[model samples]
Target: MVNNSRTNPSSDTISYLELLQEILNKKNNLLGFAGVGLVLGLLIVFTTPKEYQSSSFILLEPEGNVNSFGQMGTLAGLAGINISQLPTSQMALTSDIFPDVIHSRDFLIEISKEEFEFESKSGQIQTLGDYYFKQRPGNIVKKTINYIISIPGIVSGWFAKSDPLPSILAKSDEDQSDYLKLTSQELIAIGELKKRILLEQKGKLVHLNVEMPEPLIAAKVNTMVLERLIDYVTAYKVGRQQRNVEFIEQRVKETEQKFNEAQMRLASFRDSNQGLISQSARTREEQLQFEFN
Candidate 1:
């Protein structure tokens, strides 16, 4: 009789219905938070101001003779000259020069003036009476009145006390100047106005590609960059050519001088030897015969 009945342990566990209810309660709390968030988001969106934006794109290309050095070497070899010591590339496109030219201070100044026109104005007041006596009884009174009323700060401050003309003008000038400087710097730093500019070297081809945000600007900038690059390269090559021409002219002049001296020496030797044959005469004879042949 002392309780021989066995208890079923699994029956003591919480039922699925209770667990489902607890989970549903958490879900409801989460839904409430989401609803509040939605309302706040809608309020913010309706209150915010809208903004519009415009953008441009550009592309860049390589300028000038890409194979000039190689071509020059071949030409030199054909001319029977040793040009191995000559530089393969010119200095026109040096890394520092391009950016400096593009972002030059003078250029930015010009652009600023073109973009922003500034004007200054002054205000004046006129009054008539005995001109002086009606205003003040004596010189001392007149002087005090003039000091207090005619002086810039005293009269203008009292008259147009809240005028912001001076500050506005100053701010406008500063902003315009700063804008020009920043734009120029950005152009220089970004070089070619491209989305990206790429350079790579292969066995035969040296590849360059540039991309920009605006198609027309991209094309124009790309073309201009290429043109400038070419101009720099061409100028560099032409400079080298001019230097070579100078060297050749100098050499030719020296050779002519030597030839004249040799001729004079030969004449003097012939006269001293009474027209006798000499080694130099024989050499000259051989040179003439070679030229004729």
Candidate 2:
């Protein structure tokens, strides 16, 4: 048998290069591909929605100390109480906790329920919640990519088994709670809110930013959310002070009762004794008289 094992490495390399060159020689095909790419790029640029951000900076100060309540402070001291520490040493709210408050289910639910006149990308004015839940526009590219990526997960979930009994019991228990439990619509609103709103704290300052496709709506939402947060913090401070006021009032009532009883007893003693007096009793009586005077 004749051996024919020798192959030219240079010839194989040249052939591959010739094939690539032939493909490049087809200018019509190359131009068509380029044109398609250009059109897609332009479509993406034009079709993608525009976002407007409206932001505000806030300087958060600690709630004033209870000691600042001039006359109330004095009265508290006289009553042998520290009015300065009546409620708390400082405001309950801080920049660190502000984000948590804003993200809380109750707060988000309140925000979702609020009605704002928002003009959508399509120039139709509607309630903010409605816009978020029912009419929000989608990005074609993003939706397509997400759907493609989630194909595997969707298949797996379809095959997975679920236990109806425990799920039903847990859902019923959740429904019975007074705390804010998000419905499907409310949950969608929350997801949109999270994407649109940003919060950050620096030193003693808090910066809030809200974004939307509509400039007017963006600004309105930003202002409204900030106002809500302020109101929540103020209400907490007022509530603490109210409890302090109630405490002081109760103590005052007790002190008055004791004073009234002592006065009545002294008056009765003087009535029964008439003109009777001894040095020690006389001195005591004079002291009582001085106090009454």
Candidate 3:
């Protein structure tokens, strides 16, 4: 026997019409809450600082014949083909290392020191270090986020023993390599910059994106990074070629010295034994000729 009942307490639930009517009754409360949310959103939007972004393509494509590398990704569209893995006749520095080059400590430090006329609410010329370190001037939202994120570090700092970072200049390392001792200002500036600058490889094109709180700074930094990247790569290529040339020149000089020595020995033997017909002299001439050749 099957038992069917309309009143099942286990599965009791309201219908769609009942739910709609209940929502309608509370519409005034919902509207009030929405109004408050709208006001808060508008306040945050208007008060919060705006970040401007500027982008430029990196010039790393190969030219003429070999233009299909990872950097020169013109021919990488082929299905499941990795050019870097393939054995090629050309050995070159590709765009892969560019990210590392730009993010290098020296490169970042240099960029931090570059003075620019920063325009936010007020206009003033200062280095990137001064602007960010002195006045990262964080908003309420940023402050809350930073506080949350830094809780662990703050707790650790209490237990740990370390010197406070100096405002002007601080040692980067204990053992002293004279390698990029950063100021507290630069430390903050670099931290900010790391977030703002990005290198992305998209198919055949490599691009640089820079973001700043100000419009002009964004554009300026984008241009600066591009110029510096090109310069660094050019210098590396030129230096490699120069070393190769120097090696070849040194080899040529040594060969010339050997040739001259052989010639002199041959000439001296001929001068001393002129017209002296003997197997020893003839054998000696043959030996000298072999050596000279």
Candidate 4:
């Protein structure tokens, strides 16, 4: 009975070994796939394009009434007007108007046509069509295979496919526009050029640091953005001031008209009553003179 048990165990062990050998034999078929995968990965890494970087910095300064108002709290409080309610500090550093100005469609449209030229060799031109069109032919092939494989199954919906190149390019361009739109929409977008932007605020000081893929563009954008911001702020302030001036001028004109009418009425009253009191006094003086004669 012991020998019978031992014989049965030996047969089971042989069956397990045979299964292990079959798996090893199948692994040989996968070796070719693994080699191809490695080569494709290396090609992708080596051929991928690289981007350059550039940057600029801006230091925020207090402007207009905010600056005066802050000083008034410290030095002009004894002059009978309390300016403590005004938020000079907050106003100076406020970013409330920046996002709108930066992201305005007009502003984005202005920079959209700025040139972004890259060099290409004659040899590169020959391969450009193949790189853009044919290199990813497997994408279409895989989609077609998936569609065919699905037949009438539940996965048929997932396998719906179109020509890969046009769809891929369209998607890529759309993504690029989306990215540009985000930047064009806000002054803070300058900081989104990868990790090239830095915002620093210390005490009353605010600094905006922007980095780009080109040096001149970095400087240009930094300068232009700040200048535009200042211009917008100044124009807004001037517009407010002009409106106030108009209101004040209108009030002054109304007050002047009322004053002139009151003055004319008083003068007419004096003119009409001028002789009555004077005539009475003159008659009394004549009677006193006759008595003296």
Candidate 5:
């Protein structure tokens, strides 16, 4: 009779057993890989610098008007003025704009010059940007990683025939200016500052968080950011009022000059026609006086 079985069950079972045995034989190699992975994970955990994070919660409400000017509203309208637009107006910067203000290049650059009391290094006061760079290279592993990353750049720099750029010095608070242009180093520092600082708003409250190597410095920076934000918003609110006041003052000066000119013309007309008197002229003079007054 022809064979009914296509394959031998005994041979197939033996082959499956042999496969499992091969895997078991290489068990030491698998264990070695797992051991190396465990060591690498531990190295990363211990070698990484510890970050001190501090968060500040700010509750923002609508900017209220001190004087509603309800009583003066009618008079102000008659004089072609709006009392609501005086002294203080609605904030031009809404909550949405706050993030832009916080992340602004100029804002970051200006804040970078601010001094902070770093408790890590014997309570030394250092510029924010300088302190950030100082905190780097905390461990040997990180230093080695940084060195490795810069190897290519260093090698290329050696072969380049260009003159070396002078190192950028950190600017003191007094040395900083509103119109100051950033150098390459300053730009890099500003970039790092942006990364360290984070702003988030949940519901009606805003959370400003800053991460640093020192808790004291982180807290100080958080407070400083809050203060600066308040100051900036205040300035923005008052700045518009100041500009409007200046424009009004200029208009008042012009009006006063015109009034003086009219007075001068009336005096000259009276002087020239001293003796001339008529009922119609008297009426006309009365009308002119009323208009000038």
Candidate 6:
């Protein structure tokens, strides 16, 4: 039998020197690519609007802390109002559901409808929804890319008259529903908004962040968002407390009915045994007394 073996030891492996030489050989191409990349990066940086961020957060008291309302009581004393003796809300917004309150569509929609002074519009005040629709916030590259990508849809839209989606709030009917139907502009505004705003919770404190093209606008929007969050939290807590009060009242009614039944049973036993003297009557009276007690 004959054996034949073939092998290449340095097959596809490059030495350190050879790799350096190869890179040197393509010096011009690398430099050209680097220059093009730098140019593109610079263009992106220049075309993008500088955003300013404003941040705020609320420090909540410890859960189920009865002493947390001390400050409220103090304030009430100043106003000659005795809320200290009044009932306080037993329910609170928990950390688990806190994020939902911040990111909810209804919460965001309220913020979008708020009017703010725009520097880009020469001090003319406009709602966030309208501004987003009219001034489409994005860098030039994004707008160009979007325009190119949407060419087919835009062309089709030209041939076919398209109607805008209806807003739930804009409806003139007396009917109201739990679900929301956002208009095209509101949807666009919300999309832009979700990008500019952020919310995070650490322990009991919840932080809110808002970013905008202008400094004043960022601060204003941040304040508004915080205010809305506080209002929503207060309303939620109040509603929960009201429900708790109702539950307690129901329990109280049931207890009263049981007490009345016990009293009636005891009274009937005494009346029926008035003329009878028997061990059974004594035993029955004792049983009824035990139950009443």
Considering every candidate listed, which one attains the maximal TM-score? 6
User: Arrange candidates by TM-score, highest first: which order?
Assistant: 6, 3, 2, 5, 4, 1
Candidate 5, residue 14: the lDDT equals 100
Q: Pick the candidate with the highest lDDT.
A: 2
- Measured against the true structure, the TM-scores of the candidates, in listed sequence, are 0.35, 0.66, 0.67, 0.42, 0.65, 0.73
Tell me the lDDT of candidate 1: 0.47
Give all candidate RMSDs, comma-separated.
Answer: 19.2, 8.8, 9.5, 15.8, 7.2, 8.4
| lDDT, candidate 6, 1-293, per-residue tens | 99997765575355766888999999999999999988877878888878899999779766444344455445444434444344553344665666677667887788889888887779998888888888787777788898899899978888996566467645743365765988888888888888888888877777888998789989999998788777877787767655544544555566567768988999998997798889999999999888676
- 1 against 4, candidate with superior TM-score: 4
State the lDDT of candidate 5 residue by residue for 22-117, as single tens digits.
989999999999999888778878887778899988898886463444544554454456666564544467777777888898889888898877
Residues 39-84, model 2: lDDT tens digits: 8778777777788999999997766766556676666666678775
Q: Which runs of model 6 end up more than 4 angstroms from their true locations? A: 1-32, 65-92, 159-176
Model 5 / residue 78 / CA error / Å: 3.0
The TM-score, computed over Cα atoms with residue i paired to residue i, of candidate 5 is 0.65
Where does candidate 2 stray beyond 4 Å?
Answer: 1-48, 116-123, 135-138, 148-177, 266-293
Question: Per-residue lDDT for 7 in model 3?
Answer: 79
lDDT of model 4, residue 142: 55
Separate clash counts for every candidate: 11, 0, 0, 3, 0, 0
Model 5 ranges with Cα > 4 A deviation: 1-29, 64-76, 81-91, 123-125, 137-145, 163-179, 247-293
Angstrom error at residue 86, model 4: 12
Structural RMSD, model 3: 9.5
lDDT of each: 0.47, 0.77, 0.75, 0.51, 0.75, 0.76
